[model samples]
Target: MKSKLTTTGSRLNPSQRPAICLGMPLYNQTRFLPQALDSLLAQTYGDFNLFVSDDSTEAGPGQIVNSYAAKDQRIVYHRNEYRRGLIDNWRNCFELAGEMDYFAWVGDHDAWHPRWLESMVQILNTCESVVLVYSQNVNIDNNGGILDKKIKPGISTLGMDNTRRPLVVCRQGQGFGNMVYGLVRARALRQAGVFPRVMWPDVILCIKLALIGDIHQVEEKLWFRRRTDRFSMPRQKRALFASYRPWYFKLPWPLVNAWMLTRSPPALAGSETGPQRNLRFNLAAVYFQRWWSKFGGGSWIGSPHEWRRGKATWIRKLKKFRTAVELKSK
Candidate 1:
């Protein structure tokens, strides 16, 4: 049976409305959901409403969210009747945000520093031209131990022309882990449209936003991304597409990307003749780079040598795990 969409918790008063909307779309993320919620509730900037859209099969996620919602009025919980797939669930979250001034998508397994929202909001409020603002990230393991800290890609496009922003995204938009979680202008997000139900839709969305306005990057590390040994690149791509359409995996990435490019915003397509040619050339280059990185000799695409090397790497990881276990036993 399709579950009826229902909301819990009281709505914010019109006079006390928040300045930003934080959308968290979750599925079977009970383990880290509490931490994620706590991080949001503890934000130094408290003028934001949180919308938690639970797509979990069981009732645990809803129960968890309600427990928090009971105490905090800023959180609004919505449970889907049936599984709405990843992309659709995300779209629903954005839709539920209504007309907030700014919007951000929070990951179920991620945590944000208290200063994150305050800092990002300052940038957007000060710079009228910037549509998005994000900070560096810290990667953590399943046990919440720090793994590494790194600056996210695509930060160099901070002040670039709108026409060149897409090219910068095409080249350096490695993973949407940090960028997608950034605070974005609500108006710009609506104008650019919610995520498309396709492979790496975040990349496409980022490109569209870049065409609309500038993107700012903060140097502070405020976002914490949880890294797990769950899915490889191929598996992630397959799962993302399988969730929406069965035949999506059968299509080549280049073809799919070409079709997506045609659907870019009118501002991008209506550029001058010089910029149009540059966009085409840069997009083609990005496609070629993606193909080379995925299927080239050094990659694991049907390469026995790479497979053997991967086995050796796994063996090293096993040894480390064993050593850690032995230490705990002692």
Candidate 2:
């Protein structure tokens, strides 16, 4: 777990800060590591440290990190005792950021604009209520230029602080929450209790952070996220998680959401407008699809509605037709 830096009763004084730490976890990412590192080294903000924990099966990863560390003193290299998979590697990255005033995550395949860190830290210094800062981002290809400008989504929950609801529902993101768009306050990560055991690590963390305070949108596109065939959350894991009820609401959200829920004010609980209803409803749809697949195409009762062949039963007939087509294709 990541701990907050304390001086007085609150978070550490920002004026005394030396450098922001940028942390990343790498696993067999030799092809993309160099570009990611170069992006960081090319940052207009010079006062930052890059910590990399290598979990690659081969020495190629360590050698790449070492090559950078040799040339740039800001880069520090560490290898795991054994292989820590995705979640642990990221967990340890936040934990190792104990001394940093602010930090952000960088994936081996992700790149950033030269002004990324400089803009986020400046926003952090000015906004006390903003625990998380994110901006528009461009999605990039392997060569590290803009692939598409449209992948950047809005930070949909930005002004939720003004609403009077225990629950808040959001559509797709508008600005941030693009995985790598965040440059988070280190204290807030500790207070938020970091990422939990969720299928979407960045979304869960960003949601928790939003619950505590507000988000600052920089408007400029600084963060760049990578998308490819191999990089994804497994469909099975996503489907399984979608099937569960909003267990967080049963108790405090600490078990399911982050510590930010329990410690912060009551605003984030989703009781205000229709946020709570939308959450469960959205999750239900995701789960419903999974259940259909698991039960072999439809309800396990085996089309009891088929007995009543009426005009309203049109959906059932369409489903039967689809199933027949699938069987034929096999």
Candidate 1 lDDT score at position 172: 61
Model 2 lDDT at residue 310: 29
lDDT by residue for model 1 (130-238), tens:
7888877888988889986454453636556666676776666655556778899998887677777656678777766776777767777898878766445555654
lDDT of each: 0.73, 0.60
Compute the lDDT of residue 35 as modeled in candidate 2: 85
Q: What's the residue-level lDDT of 280 in candidate 2?
A: 40
Clashing pairs in 1: 3-81
Candidate 1 yields a Cα-based lDDT of 0.73
Off by over 4 Å in 1: 1-18, 149-154, 241-249, 266-285, 288-292, 295-330
TM-score of each prediction: 0.77, 0.66
Kindly give the stretch of ten consecutive residues in candidate 1 with the minimal lDDT sum: 1-10
Writing each residue's lDDT as its tens digit, candidate 2 over 1-330 gives: 111211123333647654588788778888887988998899887788888877677999899999999999998888988766666677777777667778887888878889988777776766566677776777777666667445644543344443321133222333324633477778777655666554444655655565456665677878777764443223423332323434443442223333323333243344534754454444334333322222211222333233344222456677789999999999
